[model samples]
Every structure is written in structure tokens, then in C-alpha cells.
Target: MTDCIVVGGGLIGMLSARMLHDQGLDVTLLDRQEPGQEASWAGGGILSPLYPWRFPDPVTHLASLTQAAFPSFADELLQETGEDPQWTQNGLLVLDPGQWDVAQAWARRWPDVQLEALDQPAVHGCEPALAEGFDQGVWMPRVAQVRNPRLMRALQHSLVRRGVDIRPRTPVSGFRVRSGRVTGVITEQGELLAERVVVAGGAWTGGLLLSLGAPPIEPVRGQMILFRGPPGLLSRMVLNDDQYIIPRRDGHVLAGSSLERVGFDKSITEAAAQTFREAAARLVPALADLPIEKHWAGLRPGSPQGIPYIGPHPEVEGLFVNAGHYRNGVVMSIGACRLLTDLIMGHAPICDPSPYRIDRADFSVRRSNAN
Candidate 1:
């Protein structure tokens, strides 16, 4: 049997495959659609969670654990693939007055991150595009963003060049388990056996895991809108009312996003576009009058408390999972992939593995061990 078969080709899956392959293991990545076209491409690519303090410790811990590694990771991809992921260290500015106190308190807890409290004048000074009347804000100087599409392409290319087998349009329906071990997968083409399997299938992960009676790992759709503007139109990503405006180096700015739990649907709505436009304009008045260049939606793997389940499937010996990252999949990929690899290879994990285990819910797949 092959060493490992990774089911799902999103960022999480690809990164998982890449990390394992680097360990001298044979790895194959399979995806339902073209890899990286799903949530990985649709996300705004903010390196940090919006209002990071609002999330629980697990979410913040995973994110913070891998915070310092992102820059070199991106550079490694670009140098090896010759594709620019546009990893920019553009600071994150939060304009929500209500969260300032809590955010500042959270910042103090983590001294590695620098968060500055800005008054009304300082807020405008930081990002002059604002329309005014903003009294309080918090600025995270270390936050960065990557162009999603570019990053996806870079990662895809990097994996191919690194000798990882990435197969798109390969829908995995379920796993082939035997005697308390995952033997392989029930793929669309046919049965493909492997020594181990990692199911990182974002929104669709739950559906595939359901055959084995896994817990709910549903989809949360987030809608996004974009605006074309000059290079300096918006400097430093601005977050307000849970919506963020991210600027690309090439004079294009992206404003997003609304969270919706609408099942497997990826439909874009005008209501969401208007909502994003209004939010973006609140931070930059010109965005209100600027044309919305694009609108799209992607299904994030929604989980309880925005925490992803990483590690073994508990019952199935060789079956592992690293899905359900919700909105933080792109940013969380670093720590989650490393952590998943460590657990899979029976090595010391990069961090505590208790919080992300599938068995944390105390549920079984009914078909714990198979015939």
C-alpha cells in the first residue's frame, strides 16, 4: 500500500501532503474539484482571525504557534515555484470600538504580538482613507496577508515540483476500513488502498466522514466583494463590524465578508455585496462609490468554536483528520499541518494535541473496527 492518501486538495490537504512527503513518505492528494479553487481561493487571506481575541484559546493558540513561520513559508513557496504569493506584512487595523478593551487585554496576555491603541486622530493617521468619526481602534503590526489565488497557485505548483502526487477531480466518498484500521479510500475512480489516510475535505469532510458516523463538520458560507482602486487606496487591512478590507499590491482592494450557514451552497448574493460595500466604505468612504469589481462565496469548514479536529480518528487506527478550520484555514494551515504530521508519524506534536482530537466530542463512528 502507498504510504499515505490525503483526501481533499484544499490548503489544509495540500499542506498536509507536502509536510508528510518532506518526511520521505509517499503521499498522494485527491480533491473533488480542482484543488485550491474552493475556500482556499475565495478567502481574503488575512493571516490572523478577525478580532482574534473573540475566539477561544485553542484557536488563538494554533494561530499564534505558527505566526512566526508564515513569512519564510511563503518565501519558500515563491523561490521554489517562481510564483509570487504576494505575502505582504500589511498590519491589521481594527476599528471596532467595542472590542478595543477586550482586544487590548488579550494582546497583553500574548507579548509576542504588538497591539497599539489608537485614538480618533491616530486612527485616521494610521489609515487616512477612513471617513472620520472613529474614536478607538487597535493595530496589530505583525499581521500579514497573502493573495488567495496567487497563494493557491504557488502552493499547487510547489507541491507538484516537490514530487507530491496531486490529483484533482478525484472525489473520495469514504474510507476502506478493516480490523480497526483504515486500509484506503472509496474514491470515485475505484478503491485505492493506502497505509494511512488523512481526510481534510473542508465543508465536504463531514459528508465523507458521516459514512463512518463522525461528528458534524458542516459548512459555513462566507460571501466576499472586491473593488478596483489605485495602489495606495488602502494601506494596512482594516477590520470593522467583523468585515475586513484587504488591499492587493496592484491597486486592487478586496472587501468582505459575511458568514452564512447555507449548507453546500456557494451562491453569491447582492445583499452580501451591498453589506460588504457599506462596511468597506465605513473605513474608506471612496469604497462606497467605487465599483465592486467582483463578488464570490466559499464554504468554510464550520466547527464548534472555530477549532479544527486534527489527529487520528480515534477508532480507526490509520485514519486521520485535519479539517473544520472555519474562517482560519488559510492562516491555521501552518500549525495544523505540522501538528497533524507529528501525530500521524507518532512523534512529539508541535503543540498540545488534546484540544483538536476527533474524540474530544466523545462520539464514536459506530463502525469503530470493521470486518
Candidate 2:
């Protein structure tokens, strides 16, 4: 029996397995498909939340705790796997007009988070690639981004190097429970016993645990469009409203995304691609001329108010969860993984785990039968 079995291979699950293994626990990670090719790879890899002040306190708190830790984490991965995640502090330019005051207030409240106000010329100065805008903007100079695909590759290699048994193409049917505690997981291959099981299955988490009664987690599809521009064509991450553009170290510029609660559909739509094109042109006129290189969509584990449930289930003694991070999965995984490990090890937590606890009376999951 493995010490812990992580039932997903995206950013959250892989990280959870690694954290568990670091504590001298035997960890096995199972995935239905290729690891990290889902939302973890499809995301723009922006290290900070988009218009973060709008989110709830829990969202902001977890995001805040993980922001500064990303660079070193990426570096550690590079050192271990020889793959550069391309962590760049290119900064984020928020052109959401009239929200500067709110952003400034948030900056003042969170001294660690640095935000600066910019006028029209200042905005132009910050991003010459942007179109002529007659308004104000908020600049987060400390915000960073990574090449998510590379980051995923590095993580896979790192996990393998540390002796994690990664079983891909192994679909999980359900969980096995006995005496109010999980004994193992029921997979297509066979039953694998574990001391603990963490359901970090992202959007599929709800469906996987439905028979076992999980929280309200559903698949929220988000579509993204990528543009291949010159290396210096776009220097920073430009955000105007919900649509934002991220430029990578290479010549590729990534623009995304839409929150469509259309089941587990991963289909690409021309309409959504056109919408991103319009957003790109609106933000940076130069993008209007460049053809879209790729368009794809991935499902996010949408939760209540975008706050991910990240603790043990109420009724299950040996079960835990670390999913439901709608758009902030990439930004919040560091803190979430650390918190999950802390809970599993029964160590002093990095932050108050109440906000993310899933066992609240109204949201508890109780299963009497041992399947």
C-alpha cells in the first residue's frame, strides 16, 4: 500500500504527490490521460490573479502567499530537471479603467503586493505595443509568468527523479471505503491501497466523487488563443477587462480565455477565437495583423466564488481534496500543495485551513457503503 495516492496528474495533483513524497511517504500518481496536458499546460501561466482585488479574501490570501515563492520553485525545477520554465517578471498592465482606486487600495492593504498607477502616457510608456488608450491603468511590476508547458515538463521529470510512480492512462473508477475510512482506490487495472487519498482531479473531481458525495465541483470550460509574435513585440501581460494577453520569453504571445460552463466540452469555437482576436486587437493593435497560431480550450474545476476546497472531507477519515480553483489554479497551486501536505502530515499549517476546508456542515460528503 502506498502512503498516499494522488488521483490526478495536473499541476495540483503532481505537486501534492511530490510534497507527500518529500516527507518520506510512498506516493503514487494516477491520471486518465497525459499529465499536465490539460489546464496546467493550456493556461497562459500568469503568476498573479487577473484583477485580483475583485476576488474574495481566501482567494487573495492564498494567491498572496504563493506569489513570491514561484520564482524559486521554478528555479528548483530547472536545477533538478535541466528544463527552464522561463519564469519572467515581465509585469502585468491592468487597463481596466476606473478600477485604479480599488487596486491602489488593495495594494496599500497588502504591502507585499506592489501596485502602481499609470496615466495614458505612462501606459503607453509601459507597453508601446498597446493601442492608443485615453484612460488610466494599474501596473503590477512584480507580477511574473512562466512557460506553462515547460514548467509541466520540468515537474514531470522532477517527480520521476524523486522516484514517484506515475501511472498514466490509468482511469479511476471510484474509491474503496470501509469503516468510515478509505481503504484504497478502484482503478481500471486493479485496486491500489493507500493510507490516504487526495482527489485533485480538477474538473472531473466532482464526477469521480459524486457517488461518494463531494462538494459542488463542475467543469467550467475556458478557451484560449495563441499568437506568435516577435520576442519584443509585446513585453508585458496586458489586461483590459476579463480578456488579457500574455507574452512569453519566446516570440509566442498567448491570449485567453472564456468561462463557459458547458459540461466537459473541450471543443474549440471560431466565435471564441474571434472574440480573443478582437480583444488582442483592442489591447494591442499590432496583434490585429498577426494571425492566430492556435486556439484550444480546457476545463477548470469551478467552485463557489472561485475558492478551491482543500481539506479533508467531513465523513471520510482518510480522504482529502485540492481542487476547484477556477482560473487561479496556476497561480495558487504552490500554496495549495503546501497546505495539503501540511494537513496530511498534521504539521503546523502555513495558513488558516478553515477557508479551504470542505467539511463545513453544508458541504460535507458522507458515504456509508464500502465500494
Candidate 3:
């Protein structure tokens, strides 16, 4: 029996498995498809929250913890894999603070976070290409970004190098439960018993839950477009009302992300692409003529309350959940992994995991009664 069986090899799954293995646990990771191709890779790689106030307290705490982990985590990944994840501390600019007051309010709620106001010339000084804006914006100096694809590949390689039983293309059919405790997981090939299981299956988590007689986790579709623009189009990440621009070192710009309620449809629509293009051009007019590099979509697992399920279930022992990160899966992986690790190891977590427990009384999985 493997010490731990981690389902879904995305950022959360991979990190959980790695942390467990580092602690001398025999860990195995199972995934339906190649590990990072899901929401983890599909993310824009912005390491900070787009706005502080949009997230609730739990999310704010999680994001704050994860942001602190990026610098060291990026360095560690590079040292282990001999590849720089291209993490840049370029800070984020809230283009219009007046319109961003809701976010400002959220930031104010959290005294632990640092938010500074930036003047027009300061924003221009940081990112020269930003179009002349009406007023000042908020500057999150510690905000950063990463080349997510590079980080994904590096993490996969790093995990493999550390002797993790990384199994790709392994589809888990369901969980094997008896007397309220999970025995193991049943896969398409065969059954593998483990002492514990952690489900980190990003968008597909809801379906996995259904197989085990659990509640629903809806998938929200997010579409984004990539652009190959001239180097130095925007120095730091620029946010304007509904859109933002993230420039990479290699002259590739990641202009994106529209929140759509289309369930599981990964197809890129003309409307979504135009929406991103128009938004990008509004922020940086030069993007109006930039070559469109790629257009794609991915599903983000969203819970009813927007907070992820990151602890053990009340109905099932030895089974833990770590999904429902929504738009912040990449940003929250560090804390999510830490919280899951603590729950599995029976140690006190750095922060209370009660709010994010899988079986919160109010959000418990409803059972069917024979009428």
C-alpha cells in the first residue's frame, strides 16, 4: 500500500505529493491526463490577486501565505530542476483605484497585507508603456508572476527526480469505501490500496465526488488569449476595470481571462477572444496590432461559497479534498498543500482549516432519501 495516493497531478496535487514524500512518506500521484495541462497550466501565472478586496477572508489569508512562498519556491524549483521558473517581482498596478474601491475595501479589511498608492508618473515609471491614465492606482510591491508552463514542467521533473511514483494518464473510476473509511481507489486498470487519499483534481473534482456519493462542485469556464507583442509593452501587470495585461520576458503577452458559466466547454469563442482583445487594447493600445499567438480555455472548479474544500470529510475518514480553487488555484497552491499535509499528518495547521473543511455543516453533501 502506498503511504499516500494523491489524485490529480496539478499544482496542488504535485505539491502535496512532494511535501509528503519529503517527509519520508511513500507517495503516488494519479491523474486522468498529463499533470499540468488542466487549470494549473491554463492560468495566467499572475502570482498575486488581481484585486485585494474581491476575495473573502479565507482567500485573502491563503493568497497572502502563498505569495510569501513564491520567492523561495521559485528558487528551490530552479535549483532542483536547473530551470528558472521566470518569476518576476514586477508588482501589480490597479489602473483605476476609484473603480477599484471594492478591492480597496477588501484590502483594508486585512491589516496583514501591504497596499500602497501609486501616482500616474509612478505607474508610468514602473511600466512606461501604460497609456496615460486619469489618476493614481494601488501598487502591490510584493506582487509577482511566473512562467507557469515552465514551473509546471519543472515541478513535474522535480517530483520525479525526488522518487515520487508519478503516474500519468491513470483514470480513477471511484473510491472504495467501507464503514465510513476509504480503503483505496479503483482505477481503470485495477485497485490500489493506500492509507490515505487526497483529491486535488481541479475542474474534474465534482465528477469524482459524484462517484463517491458526495456533493456537487461546479466548473466555471475561463477563456484567455495569448499575444506575441514587442518587448517591454508593459513592465508590470496592468489592471483596468475588467481586463489586464501580463508581459513575459520572451515578448509573449498573456492577455486574458473571461469568466464564463459555460460548463466544461473548452472551446474558444470569437466573442471571448474579441472581449480580451478589446480589453487589452483599451489598457495598452499597442496590442491592437499584436499578433495573436494562441487562444484557449479551461475549467476552474468553483464551490458555492468560492472557498476551496481543503480538509477531511465528515462522512469519510482517510479521505481529504483540496479542490475548488476557482481562479486562484495557482496562487493558492502553497497554502493548500500545507493545509492538506497538516490534516493528513495529524498536526495543527499554521492557520485554522475549519472554514475550508470538506464537510462544513452548511455545505455538507446532501443525501438522497427514498420517498
TM-score of each predicted structure versus truth: 0.96, 0.97, 0.94
**What tens digits encode model 3's per-residue C-alpha lDDT throughout 1-371?**
98889999988899999988987899999999899888888888888666657667788788878988889999999999998889998878777757446655766777666677777787677677766763687777778899878989999999989999988999999998888899889998899999888888887886786645454567788888899977766678878775888989878888888888888888889998998999988778788899898999888887765688888866788888888888888788898888888878878896889778765443344343211
| Best model per lDDT | 2
Ordering by lDDT: 2, 1, 3
Each prediction's Cα RMSD? 2.3, 2.2, 2.1
lDDT of 2 by residue, 241-295 (tens): 7999999877788988899989988999999999999988998888988878889
CA lDDT scores, all candidates in order: 0.87, 0.89, 0.82
Q: What TM-score, to 2 decimals, does candidate 2 have?
A: 0.97
- Candidate 1: deviation at residue 194, Å? 0.5
Candidate 1's TM-score reads: 0.96
Backbone atom clashes (below 3 Å) for every candidate = 0, 0, 1
Between candidates 2 and 3, the one scoring higher on lDDT is 2
Question: For model 1, what is the C-alpha lDDT against the true structure?
Answer: 0.87
